[model samples]
Target: MLKGKKIVITGASSGLGLMTAMKLVQQGARVAITGRNESKLQAAVQSVPHAGRLSTYVLDVTDAEAAAKTLDRIWREMDGVDVLVNNAGFGYFERFIDAPLEHFEQMMDTNYMGVVRCTKAVLPQMLRRGSGQIVNIASIAGKLGTPKSTGYSASKHALLGFTNALRQEMRGTGIIVSAVNPGPFESPFFQTADPGGTYVSSVQSLMMKPERVADAVVKAIVKRKAEIDLPGWAALGVKLYHLFPRLSDRIAGGMLNKK
Candidate 1:
């Protein structure tokens, strides 16, 4: 279904973004990938066998001006973007009291405001065309708070709020806004999010593969699903938490503090 479609994905240097770009390109989509590191962006383009189907841009989504300019270039180069995947974000897991104030600011800027800047830049074109799809890479952490993820969870929560509201506001406008909420995955995310390596070891068995999450992203885009939660068991846990908040905290409180 992605054949010949023009797509843009942020943070495509590695992990979920890169994997999803590969999947889309394999399905014959023309994808433009952006990342903060130029070397990594070029490397990602080289890693793909279908280089012709990919374009690379160096973008730090935190900079609103740079995001606007880079997206304008993408529109010019790709003719127009049919889909946009906001996948650029990082997590730093630290206790709320011990964490530095800057950590929270950085998370909010990249995980929440970054999406805002990119969406603002692209929405005009999508509106002009009257059809588009926006996929926001969120997390189950947003749904249920966990210890040591105060800032990260808050940022993702804000993102989910924006995504949900935007989907409603865009109703009947021919634009699809969807959110992908994945649980912990095996990726470099933990290298920074858990620099001490404690959390990864604690949840090694539960870490889903990046490829699996990427596959779900592709499916969400193709199916235009409103939302996707990875690893069915984890998703069910989130559902149960909503259904029985007090009971959930009592039953699973200890497990949520692996970090």
Candidate 2:
């Protein structure tokens, strides 16, 4: 179903975004990937099985002006974007007190405002065509705010809120707005989020494979699923947290403090 469809993904230099782009290319979709590093984007292009079907753009989603121009260029270059994946973001894990306020500001800028800017750039064309899909790469942290993820969680929470509302607005418009909320996966994201490897070690047993999560992302796109939470077991915790907030927090306190 994805054959010949034009898709754009941000942060495709590495991790889940890169994997998803490659997977889509493999499925015969034309993909345009963007990243802050030009060299890394070039490297990602080389890694794709069908290089001709993949294009790269150097972009920093945090820059609203540049993002608008770059996304517009991509839309024209690719003929049009049938799907857009808002996957550009990073996380840093430090206590609210120890972490500088600047860290949170950066996170909010890149994770929340970035999505807004890119979505705005594409929504007009999508509305004109009456069909499109916007997939926001949120996190499990968005649903259940854990220790040491205050900024990251807040940004993702905002993304989730925006996605939910956008999905409501897009109903009956042949446009799909979805959020992929995944648990900690084996990706370079932890390099910054858990430099000491403490949290990764603590969640070693629960760490998911990027390949599996990439498959789930493609499935969500094809199925037009509203939301996806990786590792069914972890999603159970989110449900429990919603049902019993105080009790869930108390019971999960130790586990949540791995960082």
Candidate 3:
């Protein structure tokens, strides 16, 4: 479904972004990947099968002006951008009181504002073209909050809201906006969490693989789905929580206490 389409992915150095890039390439998409680490980006391109169709850009999504400049360059080189996957984000799993203010700021800047910056940079062109797809890699935390993940949850929640609003506003524009909220994925996310924060030790076995999430992204883009949550059971659980907040909070509190 992505044949000959120009797609740009952020945080493409490793993990979910890298996996998604490979998947998209295999499906015949021309990919432009961005990361702060040049060596990692080079290595990622080498690892993909159609390395010729993959281009790398060293960019920090937190820098709004720099992100816009980089996007402009990419659009010029790629001819036009057909899809944008906003997957650049990090997490700090610590209690609200224990987490530093800087950590919260970093999470908001990268996870939430990063998406905003990239979307704004590309929206004018997409709107003019009247065809584009935006896939946001949010998390289950965005749907149901957990202890010691206040900032991460908040950032994702913001992304979710933005995606919803964008989708509504672009209803008849032929521009697609969707979000994927996946359960614990077996990516580097946990290991990359702030060193000072307390990480979730339990439910490790329940984590899905990064490839699963990447596959879901491709499906969402192809189908132009409004939103998706991986592992049908996980999606059901999140919905149930939304329906019964008091019960959900009690269960979540218990899980945290047990940990």
> Can you give the TM-score per candidate against the true fold?
0.99, 0.98, 0.95
- Write down the lDDT of every candidate, Cα atoms only: 0.95, 0.93, 0.89
Ordered list by lDDT, greatest first: 1, 2, 3
In model 1, state the lDDT of residue 161. Answer: 100
Q: Against the true structure, what is every candidate's RMSD?
A: 0.7, 0.8, 1.7
Residue 57 error, candidate 1, Å: 0.5
lDDT of 3 by residue, 1-259 (tens): 7899899999989999999999999989999999999999998988999888899999999999999999999999999999999999999787799888999899999999999999999989999999998999998889878777899999999999999999999999989999999988777777766353234356656768888999998888889888999878778888888899898777766764312
How would you encode candidate 1's per-residue C-alpha lDDT over 1-259 as one tens digit per residue?
Answer: 8899999999889989999999999999999999999999888888997889999999999999999999999999899999999999999999899999999999999999999999999999999999999999999999989999999999999999999999999999999999999999998888899989999999999989899999999989999999999889989999999999999999999998899
Worst 10 residues of 3 by lDDT: 194-203
User: Between which residue pairs do clashes occur in model 1?
Assistant: none
Q: What tens-digit string does per-residue lDDT give for candidate 2 at 134-237?
A: 99999999999988999999999999999999999999998999999999899999998899999999999989999989998898888988999988988999
As a whole number from 0 to 100, the lDDT of residue 214 in candidate 2 is 92
Task: Evaluate model 3: give its TM-score.
Answer: 0.95
